[model samples]
Target: MPVEMKVLMNHIYEYQKGVRRMVLFTFNQKYEPAVVDRMRRLQLPFLLQPVGNGCLNLYFGRRECLDAVRMIVDKPLSRLTPEEDFILGAMLGYDLCAQCERYCERKCRRGHCGAAGA
Candidate 1:
């Protein structure tokens, strides 16, 4: 799906205001060049990863954050291990409790119920 310009600008505004250390923006692959140009003009560090089906995920933020992401995300987002998913969610500023619940749910589904609060 193509990302809306208003939404992208809102995320950019938040990043500029230090509201988040990183932001993930997904859009059609065709817009890659224009997005790259904007990121370069803004002097933001980013990693553009293809998410298949003519889409791309733009991970923009501190160089360190991107480096961490590079280590944890060698595969598709859907293929991340539960722990890796939790880490990614945390890094993206997701609610900790929700991440924990998601982590536990994923683990439980794999027969590791000891970690699930339920």
Candidate 2:
């Protein structure tokens, strides 16, 4: 799927308007410094929560922040684990995994072994 950079920027802008802090998740360790610097420059308070296997969670101070994020990122809100979905909805006002494509063997965008044939 094509990523809409403009929409993403808008999401970020909207999120910043309502939140004091945000969380960012990344799969690339190399992107940590740069991403953090950018976030700081944007004046958005953020916490970097790193997960195993390059997953990074960006926590926002308000649910509105996540609503903006969902508008820009083309992921489905329904696909997220229940816990994650609830947190996102309650805190961010939107879900990020609703339309997200499942990682299958042949269609895995992350290229995981389990998705090799999906």
Candidate 3:
């Protein structure tokens, strides 16, 4: 996914209101201090969607869905596992995974995970 695409998609969804925003932060296997700071700074309502293979989704305001797009487009491949990266890319509207890959892909689609792949 490209940054331009992210911005464009976000612009389109920006008008929708009252929708709960979830931020999915995709992280590396190791915790990064900066990400913690970013999460703390987020003022809007949010829920953390952590990817098992180094990725997370930070849900925020109704319009914050765009942030998902932003994360996919902005984050580099080196930051996440192939599967996690593929899942994040899919979330941002870029489907890199073939149908078969879905089996291994992280379960971000469910919006949250209480147990492994839940």
Candidate 4:
């Protein structure tokens, strides 16, 4: 249910250790046949390179890059590419949680995944 809800974030909370390399949003699935072409028509800075097995790879060098793409689009989050998913995940603090493994939403401290060995 939460994944399908509206995500209000405008940026990704990247945790880069050194120089900020581009953030990679990997989608394990691909869009519909014409979706890539439609994205191109919008003409944002995103370069949606096609990955094997019907996946899509989006690379972003800065938050502004994503902002530009979002600005020119009016579709619902579900209809957007994997970028939306990354945004929502960052907003929800999916990177880590400070508590239980499966139920908590807080960002995990240290290297623990809140699932013990997980």
Candidate 5:
């Protein structure tokens, strides 16, 4: 191969290597407790990088992506495969809102609801 082509290939390989090992999760400050509980229940390993205001950056091996994604979402943790890893799982979790802000007639915790609790 030409020198320029070799250099280009080497650059691409380096860039891919730089990103292959980083698996991280960022969570809202208020949900830290829930996130931590979820992680503990799953029993995965992590390095917690505490951000200000009770937020955190949880890092783990790339293999732990699915478990990390489950920690932040209101989902039942199912068996995970690499193809269905955290990069996409987190995106799917964001499609629905968390239960903390949700309200309905059945569990009317807010006064403005039409249920008995109103």
Candidate 6:
């Protein structure tokens, strides 16, 4: 089932308050039409991607941010490149330090990190 309306409203409230540039929610595919209708009524910009198993990932926020996401990410969210992951995290208002740490870890794991003290 999709999340409670109150939960979705809380995310919407944060967006309206300018506290978040982007937000994501996972919902059953069955809810897509209703969710899309609501977003249209509110004139909110959004992107919806199917995530298998009758689930969808709904991303809503600034139009430019959504556009950038569309351009940068062509694969599943779980398969995002480190830079793509970093960009998404930053745009979602995640902690910068944590995002940075996560990016560095991902790069290191991929053997793309530069040698220490180089």
- Name the 10 consecutive residues with the lowest summed lDDT in model 2: 98-107
lDDT of each: 0.91, 0.49, 0.46, 0.41, 0.45, 0.88
Q: Residues 10-63, candidate 5, lDDT per residue (tens digit)? A: 433443465434344555556556556655665544456565566565554444
Ranked by lDDT from best down, the candidates are 1, 6, 2, 3, 5, 4
RMSD (CA, Å), each prediction: 2.5, 11.2, 12.0, 13.1, 17.3, 1.9
TM-score of 3: 0.28
Top candidate (lDDT): 1
What digit string (tens of lDDT, one per residue) describes model 4 on residues 1-118? 2221111011223423323333445454434334345335544244455556766655454457556544633454445434444444453345534223322322333233445473
Q: Of models 1 and 6, which has the larger lDDT?
A: 1
| Global local distance difference test of model 6 | 0.88
User: lDDT of candidate 2?
Assistant: 0.49
Clashing pairs in 6: none
Q: What's the residue-level lDDT of 26 in candidate 3?
A: 41
* lDDT: worst 10-residue window of model 4: 1-10
Each candidate's TM vs. the true structure?
A: 0.92, 0.42, 0.28, 0.28, 0.31, 0.90
Q: Model 6: per-residue lDDT, tens digit, 10-115?
A: 8989999988889988887887788899889999999998889998888999999999989977889889999999999998889999999999999999999887
Encode model 2's per-residue lDDT on 1-118: one tens digit a residue.
1243343355577666754244444335556665566667776655555555765555444446656555544344435544444454445433445423322322343344452364
lDDT at position 79, candidate 5: 30
Kindly indicate the candidate among 4 and 5 with the higher TM-score.
Answer: 5
Candidate 3 C-alpha lDDT tens digits along 23-78: 34444534444444544564344445555566554434444555554565454445
> How many clashes in each candidate?
0, 26, 17, 4, 0, 0
